[model samples]
Each structure stands twice: as C-alpha cells, then as structure tokens.
Target: MKVVIAGGHGKIAMLLHPILEEKGHTVKGLIRKEEQADDLRKAGAEPVVVDLEKEDDISEYVGEADAVVFAAGAGPGSGKERKWSVDRDGATKLMEAAKKNDIERYVMISAMGLETPRGDDVFQVYQQAKLQADKALRNSGLNYVIIKPGRLTNDEGTGKVKIAEKLDRGEIPREDVARVIAEILEDDTIEDVEFDLLSGDDEIKVALQEFV
Candidate 1:
C-alpha cells in the first residue's frame, strides 16, 4: 500500500512513517516547508512540498496513492481564521483530492469530544472546524475511518488502547495513536467508522476487533 500523510512533519505523522514502512508500505508525506524533507526522509517517507492552506487543488500532490491521511492542523497558537483554513478547509480539500484521485481509503486524525464546543473563542472555533471536517468526511461517501483520539501525549507507546464509538474524555500517547492508524490502514475490515481512542488494557489489534 502507498500512503500519503498531509502533515508529514507532525509529531504523530513522523512516528507513523517508520511503522508504515516496516509494514512493507510506501509512504509519502506532504510538507509545507522544503527543509522538512530531510526529517521525513530520515523517518522513511518521501516528502512532497505543498502548502495545504494555499493550494486550492492538491489532487496533483496527492497523486496516485492507496490511501490519504489528514493530519494537518493550524498550531494551537494560531487564530480562529487559521483554524478554518488549515483544520477545516485543509481537511476538506484532502477529501476532494481523494475523490478526484480515486482514492477510496481516507483516514482522518481528528479530536475527541468535539460535539460540545468549549474553551476560549479560538478553541471553540478549532473544535467547530474539526467537527465540520469530520462531518464532511462522513458524508464524502468514501471508505473512511476517523480516529478521534483524546489529548495527545509524548509518552512511550504501550501498544494497548481502548476504542469505542464514544469514550470518556482521556488522553493517549502520540505513539499509540500512530500505531492504531497503522493498524487501521492494514485492516480493510475497518471502514466508514469513527472511534474514540485512549490508552487502556487491550492490545492494539484486540481493541480494534470490535470495529472489524
């Protein structure tokens, strides 16, 4: 399988590259900065430089890939406008690209507990943007899996997780999230479903069994 990740240089995406490579899949990461290419290369992924916020049509960048992952985001410090551009619009553009390129599998790295918008104005907008993007993917009529993970941490991955249609607010390591994404990409049985993820007792494969 060939996989394209929109935020190639992101923390979770960087972790995911090597895992996908080890699974015998080709990986390409879409990066906004040219300098990020080396980092992606070291992680075993080819880097394609394309600014998601600026590109109206990114289908060419997406090219021929078996799957595309929407992992790009406006940083937490950015304003509400960027939230719409990078988070909502960027993700939607990827969905369009996937459809244009005939890519049936799209995996979205969304957030959990977005149904109730909270936080400051900017944060609320961010949540709203994510919610909109998730809705778009769900209605896009593609084989999609939206993994809504809780607060992300940098802790080491334990390879155990809890997945369900709705999970209590919690947190999980970025590494574990990447592991789950990798597993989902390989498991064709998991499609058109969204789930909340957190660190728990079940192994990665076992936790995903219910979705299969």
Candidate 2:
C-alpha cells in the first residue's frame, strides 16, 4: 500500500516507518521543512513539504497516495498557542486534503479524553486541540481510526497491548501504538471503533485483533 504520513519524523513515525516498510509498503512523509525531507528519506519514505496548519489545495498530494496518516504535530518547541494550530488546525488541513484527494482510509493518532468540551488543565489544552480534529474527522464522511493513548513513554516495545472498544482508561507505549497503527493500515476488519491503548501483559496482536 502507498501510505502518506503527515508528521513522518515524529516519535511514532520512528517506529512506524520500519514496520510498514518491513511489510513492503511505500510511504510518503509530509513534512513542514525542506530539511526534514532528508530524515524522511533516510527512514525509507519519500518526503513532501506541506504545512498542515494552512489551508491550500491538497488535491495534488493527497490524491497520490492510497492511504493517509496524520502523524504530524507542532512539537514541544512550538509553544502552547501551537496546540490549536498544529493539533486542531493542522490536523484538519490534512484531513481536508485527504477528502479532496479522495483518500478514504485514514489513520489518526489522537489524544485521550478529549470528548468533553470543558477542561482547563494546561496539558488538557492538547486535548482541546485534538477534540476539534477528532470532531472534524468524525463528520468528514470518511473511514478513520483515531488512536487515543494515555501518557507516552520511551519504553521498549513489549509486543503486548491492551485495547478496549470504548476504552475509558489506561496508558500505552508509543512503540506499541506505532505497531497498532501499522495493523490498522493493513486490516480492513477494524470498522469505526475509537481505540485507547495501554501497555499490559496481553499479546499486542491479539489485543488489537479483539477490536476487529
């Protein structure tokens, strides 16, 4: 499959690139800077410079891929104000691009507990931004899998993941989340279920397959 990854150089993308490539999938990394293109290339993915925060004609790039992944983010360097720009507006831009390109299968890495509209916690600001993005995707009339994880860590991949259809709790490793993203890309069995993952003793594949 030809996969277009927005934010392909992110922590999640670090693990995703190898998993997808190992499965023989072609990847396109949508980056914001021309310099980031080199890193994407080294990861075995073709890079395209696109600022997902801005509105533009994405028909060209989105139309070229079979699937799209919104892995792009504003990053920690981007101040708190960027929460809206990158997480909400940026994500919306990418999805709009996908819609224009006629790409239906989209996998998004979202945040946990953004379903509500009220929260003032500083960290929860990210959730506010993600909430807007998630709402847009839900109303986009497209097939999307929104993976919302608790806290992220640099722990090694345990190959075990816990998944619940309406996961009301838990945290997971970014690596395992990356692995799940790969699985969602390949499997058509996963319908329109929102997933919240966490690191546990259960087998990763099995836990994920449960949702299928």
Best by lDDT: 1
In candidate 2, stretches whose alpha carbon ends up further than 4 angstroms from where it belongs are: 116-122, 166-170
lDDT of each: 0.95, 0.78
Q: Please report the candidate that would top TM-score against the real structure.
A: 1
Instruction: Encode model 2's per-residue lDDT on 121-171: one tens digit a residue.
Output: 645777678887888888888788888876788888888877775566567
The TM-scores, one per candidate, come to: 0.99, 0.90
Q: What is the C-alpha lDDT profile of model 1 across 1-212, one tens digit per residue? A: 99999999999999999999998999999999999999999999999999999999999999999999988899789999999999999999999999999999999999999988788999999999999999999999989999999999999999999999898999999999999999999998889989999999999999999655
Quote model 2's TM-score: 0.90
Q: What is the lDDT of residue 105 in candidate 1?
A: 97
> Which 10 residues in a row give candidate 1 its minimum summed lDDT?
203-212
CA error at residue 66 for candidate 1, angstroms? 0.7
